[model samples]
Target: MKKWLLTTSAVVMMGSAIPIAWAGDGLWRHVPSTHAHSSARAVAGGPFAGHADVQHDWQLRSSVRVSRQVLREAYLASRAVYTEKLQKYAKVTPSQAKKAIAQAHPGMKVEDVQLRNIRTDLVYTGLAQDDEERYLVIVDAGNGKLLLDRLLPTHHERVFSGD
Candidate 1:
């Protein structure tokens, strides 16, 4: 969810592929790329670049940390639920859930498909939209059971910057 670290050229190249940064259930929405700009200072080397091993060191240590963080964020509601172990257990993939959600919601556009934690089970959630209307559809990842199908507020488009 903390996508703010995305570099400028990377963000611009990504464009629409930018995921809708989520906050909490209804507290998330799409952040228009209009505000994503590159400052010269940001693009250029900083004063410490020549003096420190900052970039190289982080590049070396970040892989494991990044993977762990992403998995950790997946089950924010159930912090103890270590989601790195999810692949071995989840019967349903996000793509499968997306197809099912689209089939169920007809004209709804699937904005994002993410893993969420409800009670103790891993749940797959689909953030969807139809015109100006929004919807949230969830299914149990373990048994493929429908858990939640609800309409969200229409104007709930406040951009989340992972804060």
Candidate 2:
């Protein structure tokens, strides 16, 4: 009976420890990359020449942190692209940004406008008509601000081969 009781207690203790191990939830382990770029100066080296060890040595110390930073930058750039497209195509002015939003999206007001400035490699908003939603407008692609008109998305003119 004594041996059985000791065995049961040990099993019960081990089982209870499992839940405790899960408290970290693995979220901290994978901090995400965006967090690293919150402060641009936080990470050094060059446009993209820094070594992993160098970046890890900074305030952030994990791949997840670097990823979090990259994501945030991408989001910001996306917003900038949206705004720039609207302004260029729709001719939305800063003073008239609100008015354009109202006109483009009737009955529905602009909740918020985000700007994104992608890297030079990719097309600014894929070089299209630039308008995604009636409520949301791409004011200009150059500056990356929101606009007020019914901007169209990019329309690619395909080439016919061997006609």
Candidate 3:
């Protein structure tokens, strides 16, 4: 055990000594750390500095940020198109849609009305809720006819079919 320990210590000493022979510094190599030194951060935020270094100054603008902006703009454009379709094709007003929901479900109160396209059909979808249950009622956008009145599940896995 003592021979093994001596041999291991000798190997470690030789391994450490090689770096000291190659480069004069035995303590640290030329590898940069993952994060900058705390002194650099202190100097950056210190009062003595003329220009304040914001967090964004050091943060990289990644493709994820670009994609998020692109997604937001695309959503806005799609919403504008939906709004145009609602104005052009929807003969029924929001009040009429709410009234349709009220007629079918006596106790349910219509909370919000939205224009949505289910595949190819444009409908006025309304979220209705009573004391215990919630429902989603759909009214035909073209002729003001009641299309679907279904109870929305409280918790369920949604399977979306996308193009």
Model 3, 41-156: lDDT tens digits are: 53565522222221212222546334557545555555555566566777877778788888888877887787777897888889889877888889898777889888876543
29-67, model 1: which lDDT tens digit per residue?
322223233223223654222322122212123343335
| TM-score of candidate 2 relative to the true fold | 0.23
List residue ranges in candidate 1 displaced over 4 A. 1-83, 156-163
TM-scores, in order shown? 0.44, 0.23, 0.47
**lDDT ranking, best first:** 3, 1, 2
Candidate 3 accuracy as TM-score = 0.47
lDDT, model 2: 0.41
In candidate 3, position 1 carries an lDDT of 60
The per-residue C-alpha lDDT of model 2 at residue 144 equals 34
> lDDT by residue for model 2 over 50-138, one digit each (tens)?
33322222233445333557545555554454465554543334545544455545656354443333443111221112234332354
Q: 119, model 1: CA deviation in Å? A: 2.2
The number of clashing residue pairs in each candidate reads 0, 47, 0
What's the true lDDT of residue 101 in model 3? 82
Q: Tell me the spans in candidate 2 whose CA falls farther than 4 Å from its real position.
A: 1-92, 113-134, 141-163
Off by over 4 Å in 3: 1-81, 156-163
Top of the candidates by TM-score:
3
Candidate 1 residue pairs in clash (backbone atoms < 3 Å)? none
